[model samples]
Target: MLVAAKGERFCDQKRPGCSQCARKRALCPGYRDMSSQIFRDLTQVTVRKYHAKRSQSAIASSSQNKSPKLVKAKPSLSLENVALNFFIRVYAPSSPSAWLTYLESVLSCTDANSQLSLSAVLAPAIAIFSHEQKRPSLMYIARRYYLTAIADTGLRLTSIQHAVRDSTLMSINLLTLFEARAFQGRSPPTDWTTHIEGAVELIRLRGNDQFKSVLGQALFLDTVNNIRTSCAQRRIALPAPIQDLLQTLLQKDSPPLSYGILEIGVGNVVDNIIGLVAGMQTGAVYCNDYKAVILEGLRLDSQVSELSRQLWSIQSYRVLPTDASGAWRWSGLAHDYDNPQSARLWNLLRMLRLYLNKWICRAYKKAVFEQQQQQKEEKLLEMGQEFQHIPETAASNTVLMAEYILSSVPYFCSLILSLEASSSSALSSTVRWLIWPLSVVAVSPLSPVSMQIHARDCLRKLGEEMGSAQAVEIANMLDNSETLEDWYASHPRMIVDQKAWF
Candidate 1:
């Protein structure tokens, strides 16, 4: 009997090569040491097996003695389960089907088996869930992921291939949202503004073609609106490219689903007003163009008035009557049905009109100054004639609009609070989107004291429920008994300039 050599278990009686040797195309070094083959019997095999078992036992004992600490592996979290819960119970109510689809896509991308899921997308989602669940540990996880996303985005920014992808843009948007949700109003203002600014840069790099897609357009418009807020608050003009894109968007027949034509009209008028103010701040020589500036203001004001009239003419534009307590109520009855959306929209228009009137007053002040400087009595008289159309007391008009904006808060709050989850989600999103505007109204000095208190309490409640620090801060500011105008007067740097429409 031919015996196999040690470590040559594949050797058989084959003369040329063993199976392993043949597979490797190597010369067979077969079992040539056969001297002990005859002597090696069944007893030897049994002894060898016994020794092997004893060695295994000895090694196990030695290992156990050397290291008794055997930590069990921590199990991976079931992110999918949490995400599904978030989708069904929270997100679906607050957003549209499109957002739900986006969330699903992020989940699929982040599957354990796939490499496509990104930290930027994943981080904000985790953070949002963590905030909603009030999970501090999960918040830590979210922060880590958020940092990872930022680093990843930084790397991608250097790579055109990675940076221009839609996912990259979505990541930025999510991160901004994370800041908004996670920080609420506690973090520095730039925490969210930086993300917003980064998104604007990404949009610029992506260009007008990005707007061809529905999601791209939506994201673009959304980011631009945010940028508009940041710039307004900071008293800066939007980058020319962004300003141009906004103009182009406004020219379109339809805006985003959350925005309306009237809203855009209001935004346009506000932008014009803001632009004029910004120009005036820089000491631009507008004497040559004083008439043009006055005419532009008038034209924009007329545009707003016409838009307001259009809203009034809408079949569903009925105004809800005030209750006995003097609180505005949502009259959901037939022919007097309360469309929260229409009410909100109308309130927004009213606010814009008030804002436009204020701008007209400023324009008059500026034009009057310019005329006085030019020593043109005839021009001054002409300007005085044009100014006659404006409210006699612009400050009173300001208060009226601010009061109206606040008066509707009760109805809005009740509508949002009382509606079914799905309906509330829709209205809540609209209300949330209008936070800056609402804040504007809340802080307006002209808002009545009682209405201001109502606005403050309602805003704080909404902020707490929605996890918006901006709302909470606005409420706090109102609670301090300072109107926004007064607050801005004291802290000129914190002026609320409405350059973008809701």
Candidate 2:
């Protein structure tokens, strides 16, 4: 028999290395007998999911039985911990007291450094309020954390005070900034009143140059832009002074930001821009005034380059070097999406630009002829990779789309984990986890309704990923397809095989 030529079989107990498997998985059954099929099973993570956590629990237990870390099982989670986790995810309580009680519960524990305390409540508290979608009190939870930080860490330095306020500011800034970035290319918080308020607060707080300037500087441009923005919104003057300051800043020959002052300034700017664009108000006034300022800023902005340089230096999420043409394609590494604007936007912009470039190159061939030509480049980092040969069928198209969703699943999972304490994000987390298997049903030989049920299940889990239009585009590419045939007819091969067929 030509079994050897057929490649490794999972049915065979001896499996080849992944490199070998990669060369051979297509022709052969995986090496674990039918066990290789485990990877494809979209069933709930189920029993096997707890392998490490269980080990931790056992260690926790063994520590109780034998070790010092658990003299009285100090690491043991308390009822408060449970309640904190519960409140963080479900919001079962109608009042802020419920949330505070949970935080207090964690605080009641012996040492403040308990992993359960931070992991279960505070960290997630940050994530939850960040995406709560309830804006009545944007920094409502931040006030809680501001107090908690003081309680937990004991404020000593002026920077500690600065940190407390800045952390809260960062939370507000990050949420709005990302909202602006993802909703469209609009950047920064542009609301004049808010920017002025924030700047005034910093000034009043006796902030240092490093500490205070971010607030003041962020306001300087944003307030002007916002005032101009409002005028533009109401069809008012372009506000030339604002234009001049923006130009002066853009033109000023400055070195890149040093970590201390630079990050604060740039971060504040980013925060403001983030808040600004989240409003998504489009107009000729913004185009002529604020838009020009931002473009000029970008052209002259060293902060972005600094950020880009810092992002490039991270070893864990390393993507390809900037292409020969200096193109920074998105590498699709939202694995650690702590910096979603940088990670998600980087890939999205790369893809968007690539798509636009393809269209331009085709429609205006002479333009490309006149311009300097650069070779097509790969995405900066892998920008995520494609799955292997999904079964070929009309369903393959659906499977293809689903696999991309599955790939993005980890990113959403990271978000969920960050918000694990927040019932909302937990629900989001659960939804993202639940999405994969349900998606798998459609691609499998299961009945059509099974796929539909799976589709419904997936949409339910999609939470944040499903709510936005762009996410909807990604989702439609995932769950929203009408017929498997339509995807087959219209979907490009790359689109179909992004994950499996890569």
Q: Against the true structure, whose TM-score is highest?
A: 1
- Candidate 1 structure, TM-score to reference: 0.65
TM-score of each: 0.65, 0.27
- Per candidate, the number of residue pairs that clash is 3, 37
User: What tens digits encode model 2's per-residue C-alpha lDDT throughout 131-220?
Assistant: 553433424343343333323222211243433343333222222222221221222234322332343333334333322343434423
Number of clashing residue pairs, candidate 2: 37
Q: Name the regions of candidate 1 deviating beyond 4 angstroms.
A: 1-76, 83-89, 96-100, 106-117, 184-188, 246-267, 284-296, 326-339, 362-403, 419-476, 479-501
RMSD after CA superposition, every candidate: 20.0, 22.1
Q: RMSD of model 1, in Å?
A: 20.0
- Name the 10 consecutive residues with the lowest summed lDDT in model 1: 491-500
Error of 1 at 86 (Å): 1.2
User: Where in model 2 is the C-alpha error above 4 Å?
Assistant: 1-214, 220-243, 250-310, 314-345, 348-359, 365-409, 423-461, 464-502
Report the alpha-carbon TM-score of model 2 versus the true structure. Answer: 0.27
